[model samples]
Structures are given as C-alpha cells and as structure tokens.
Target: MIGSSHAVGTDAGKSVENTFTLDYQVSGVSQGTITNDSAYTGGAGDPSPVIDPAGPTNFTVDRMIDLAVTADNSGLVVPSNAQDRILQYTITNLGNDHQAYSFSIADVAGDDFDATGLEITYSRAATDLNGDGDTLDACEAEIVDAPLTATVPGTAAGSASYTCDIPADLPFTVELSGDIPDTLADSNIDNLVLVAETRNPNAWAVEAVAPSVGGVTANDADGTNTITGLAENVFADGTGTSEEADKDGRMSAQSSFVVTSPDLVAEKRVWVLRTESDGTACAGEAVPAVEPTTEYPTPGACVLYTIEVTNTAENAGSDAENIDVSDILPENVAFVSATTSGFNIPGTLTFKKADNTTNCDGTAGETCTVALTGAGLAAEVGTTDATAQLYIRAIVR
Candidate 1:
C-alpha cells in the first residue's frame, strides 16, 4: 500500500512508521510487445513511482525508547521505632516499546538513626492514581499509600524491631502487564517501604530508587532484533545526545521520619476530701480537696491525691517499660481509706476502676503510699489519646 507505515505488532491503520512498500508493472501491449516496469516508495500517503527494471525504495522501521522516574513526597509522615515507613514513587516509560524494570535503593541521608538497619522492601505494581498514562504528571492524585502492601510474594507486610545492619543492600524486579499499547501506556509505580525497630529519637528522611543499571534487548517474531546498543539512557529519536534525556530510569523519594522514644510525664493534683472537727467524713461523697490553707492538713481536713501518667510518643516495637507512680504520704499525714482506680496493685489487690475507697497502708501515723509496677499499670500510656494516658488516686491523713 502506498503512503502507509507500519510498526512491529501494530495494526494496519495504527503504526506511524514509513515502512510499507508497493511494487507493480504495466502489462498492456506496447509497440506489439508487452513492457512492464514500475515500483514505488512512500509512507503515510506519499508514494513515489520508480522506473523498474530499476528498483523499489527500501524501507526501515524506526524504533524508539525513553524512560523517566520520580518519587512522591506529599503529606508523608512516619514515627521512629515504627515497624515500616512506606515511601511512594512513580515510574514512567516514555518509549514506544513495553518494558520490565529492575530496582535498587540509595540511602540519601545517613546518620545514627538511618534506615540502613531496617528491612527495606519494594512493593508490587501499584494502581496508577493518575490513570492509563505513561507519566505521573499526566494524572492528579496523591500517590501516598499502597492499597495492599503485597509486592514480593511470600513477604508478609509490616515493619518490626530494627535489627537489620546499616548499608542495606537490596535488589528487586517487576514486569509490567497488558499487551496493547493503549493498555500498556500507563504509569508503573512502587511502594518502597522501610521497616526498623530502633532509631535515634530524632527526625530525618530516607530515599530509594530503581536505576537502569543495564541496556535494553529484545527479538521480533519476524526473526530479527530491531533494537541494539540502546543503553540504559536511550532516545528512539536519534541517540538523545545528552545523558539526562536518556537516563537509565532511576527514581528515588524521601519521607519524614521521627523516632519518638516513649516519654513519661505526670500531673499531680490535690483536693480536700472532707472536713471533720477532729477526723474524716463518709466516703460516699467528699469535697474536692482545697490547696492546704495551712502548712498541712488540719485536724479534720484530709487530701485526695490524683496522679496521672502519660506516655508522649507512639510506640509499636519498643514500648515504655516499668511505668510506676508512687507518693510516700506525709510523715504525719497518716494512712486513711484510699481508693485506687485503673491500676492493678500487687498482692491480690482488688483491681477496681472507681469507688473502691480503701487505704493502701494500714499504719496510722507512718508514711502511707500507693505503688504499682510495670505489669500492674493498667492501660499504660501510648501516643493515641486512647492509649496515651492512665491515672490513680489516694487519700491520706
């Protein structure tokens, strides 16, 4: 067909290359003898007639390839000692041929709490947030999380205690899906995540990527390799002279990470439980302890001490240990009926939440006290408001 072009595996009307050839000869009588000689060369509707016994123009298909990659750092936040912190990235193949990509990582920022010691993993292909397009810029969406962290088979999801050594060396691969150009013309993204148990109680960022460490190679069904010498940085449109245009498709990204060691804080409050001329009152209803007006509690006035403990950081792997709260009652305040809430004191103590008013110590004049060890602390604090705090109370003479 004249003026038509064809690409490998492309439909008759789809290929844009000028590779179609047309040849023919005249068979009508000429001076009592038949003279047949004609051939032509053309592409996309431009065919030229050549005198033959002469020759038809030879046509060659033009192959092209281009690749570029980048990372996404939008609204990404991670806490230290966290099992795994995921970093997202988008890869785009700007070439005309379908491709399979290899991956690697570059610990951009190195320090005492670097991700080098964490279990670094690359996720399987993620759905394109931008749609069926080759470049991430073509679509609009915050590519932050992996719907399912299943990238490499057999690898369960999550980051645990950081036991990995620094200078983590990892390599992975992913082959794209789809057989048609339109279907194939979509962005291939990855859920590059890092898991660690230990990190400096500070803030930092880490980056990783998959570089084109090698060249491209493939064979056509017609029995000939149409592409060669296409290095990692290839430009189908004439060797993209500058290496930048033909980069080996390497993309890396960084995410904010903060190692927050559990910090324990406390708030101690006192209120006058009741006022008796010489002693205490009924436990059913007592007045809020007023700040002692005198040096200490008067003859009938007593104090209700409330202590609250809070763990000011989110912990997944290494949690706060030995969380305890204690206050030796005033040397002369004497032990009175005490009530413990949200705590498990040792010695088969009645672990009650509220309204369990009973003295922790029986001594009438000696220093009375309330104490609970690591295991006795009920609902030990964590970062979330749900787990971040716990409290206890006691009454003393």
Candidate 2:
C-alpha cells in the first residue's frame, strides 16, 4: 500500500533492489557463509547450487501526482458596479509526496458576463485580536496579493505565475478577486474556474526570470523511458467538473458570482369614461373605474391606461440606464393619444407607435414604445427618486 499512509521513499521510475545472505551447516559443522548474488555462480571459493542464481531482485517505483480544487462555499452574491469581490476556494494535494503547484484563473464560457480585473490571491485564517466573536475589526488578517505574469500555464524556465508550497495531504486556501461590470441586471451569474498545475519540484527554489516553452520542462517524468534508480514525475490528476483534462498535471474547480441589484417594477392600470354615439366624451370617474367582472366598457368608451416604471430600493447600489418599454393595444381598441411624466433633467421620455410616428391615427392593434434615453433611471436611494409614468388614451371600437 504505497499511498499517503506509507509513501514511497524513492522517486517514480526509480529502482528498488533487495538481496539475501545465508550461513547454515550441512549436518553438524558450519558450511561457511554464502551471500546471494544473481551474477555469481560458484566461482573459485564461492560455493552454491551452481545450477541457478539466487536473489538480488529489484523493481521500479512509479510516481503519482494529483491534486484537487474545491469551492469553499456557495456562490458569492455581489452588487452591481462593485469592486474587489472575493471568492474563496481550497486546493488539496492528493499525491504521495510533497508537490509545488502553479495556479491561474479563467472566465468560463456560457455565462452571463465576464468579470473584470481578475486576480489571484492567498487567504489566511481570520484572527480576532480584539476579543470579538467575528474578525470584522482592523486586527483581522488581510489577503496576500500574488502578482500575475503575462504567460499563464508556463512562466520562465524556473519560475511560475503563482506558486504554492504544498505538502502531501494538505489543503491551502486561495482567493480570487474581481470587479463587477456596471449596469448588470439582478440574478445574473458569472462563473470562474481556478486551475492548478503541478510544477517541477526542483524549480521550487531560486525561480529565474527567463521565458520557457512549457511548464514542468525540466526533469519531467517520462512514462515511456522510465529508467530504474532515477525517480521521475507522472501526472495522475483526474478530470474535474470545470472541464479540466485528465493526466495533464492540472486540476480545476469553479465558483460563481450572482448579481444582487435593485428591482425595477413596471405596472399598468386602466380606467373607462362613458361617451356619446358621436364619440364625444361624457362625464366619467377620474380614477380607474371599470373593474373586471363588475362593469364592462361599452362601445366608443374612452379607456385611459397608466404604466408606471418604479426603481425599487430592494438592493443597494443598483442604478439602471437605457430603459425601454413597449405596450401593444389589443383587438377592437383604437389608439388615441399617449404622454409621459416624471422624466426630466438629462433624462427624456418619448412615446411612439409601431410606425415610429407620434400619432397613431386611431389604429387598432398598434404598439406604443415608451423609451427613456440620455440619462437613465436611478433608484430611490437617499434623496433621489427615479420613476417614470406612461399614460395612454384608447377607445373601444
């Protein structure tokens, strides 16, 4: 069982030999000494069976290098336009012997958006020096920033992008910091994968600054040319959920960031006004009067609908921009007029029919698009309020 419990002393592809020595008497007296040697067969003074050679057997020990990366917890929830969001992870060495690892992170495809200014860092256990239960005070630990190199997976011949000195069967905490893009919607997710590759143990010390062709280029393990008495490296890392390939001296794991932004809700309410046969408007309730199943609007009745877009202060730091909303009139209803309010300053709201005209010409089944351009809406935070209302007047055919 050559595993972490009983690790192999010799390196992989190295030979291990054993021999035996015997000293026995034939009947009553001593028969001298006879040491087993596969190359010797009863030469001058050497006494043996002479027919076969005895033990001096040897075998080669193979190397197994593996590692694993896992997310520390669930996905991190971040705010829009946030910076330096921290994502934590753990890297464990699953090999029989101590290993040096190089780390890098990448944005995974098929996600909502890519995080900006990605950086790799080291995280230590939080300490409460102020006698508090949490490490929120200034006495707590800070993240150790690791400088990134332009070339990933491979650095200088004797260098790496980010290296960690990890012993066998041990786990190290790593962190990734990134900035969230501006104006991202709530519930949007961006996944990032962290990759750790096994580097040459020899290069762990005295890293030079010279470009190299590939990582682990010096004294690398050769599966085909495995010679005895010389240990070599062999990749045994398994494929991971983050699309990390097997036996490539690399392992990966993924974590995500979910955006938590202010909720922007739009609601529409409608009312009715009685009219004459000549389409002349008559007296009616100023507010929404007709309720479903209670009272229905008659032919040529004036219907007034109001659509309100409210930027609720559900989550903090969530301001919106480039707002556009469209409402299509149903059958048997002719479009009359439309207007907007609550949009001023740099922000301007405009309403247009499907044909991009200000007037809809009393046409049924027409779509009216209300757009707020220039400066977009801001959430009702502090003293600022961002709300827009669209009013439409339509008539039943």
Write down the TM-score for model 1: 0.29
Residue by residue across 1-397, what tens digits does model 1's lDDT show? Answer: 1112223222111222222333454574222211223423244543344334533233232333333344454223333333344444444433433333333333333422333223233333232322355324311121222122223322321221111111111112222111111111112122233211111111101111222222222222254443322222223322211222222232333333333344344667766554542323434444343454543445545555666554433534334456655565555554445444443432232322122354444345454445545533332334352122222223344
Candidate 1: worst 10 consecutive residues by lDDT? 176-185
lDDT of each: 0.33, 0.60
Model 1 / residue 290 / CA error / Å? 52
Evaluate model 1: give its lDDT. Answer: 0.33
Q: Model 2, residue 91: what's the lDDT?
A: 83
Q: Candidate 1: where is the Cα deviation over 4 Å?
A: 1-63, 109-112, 116-397
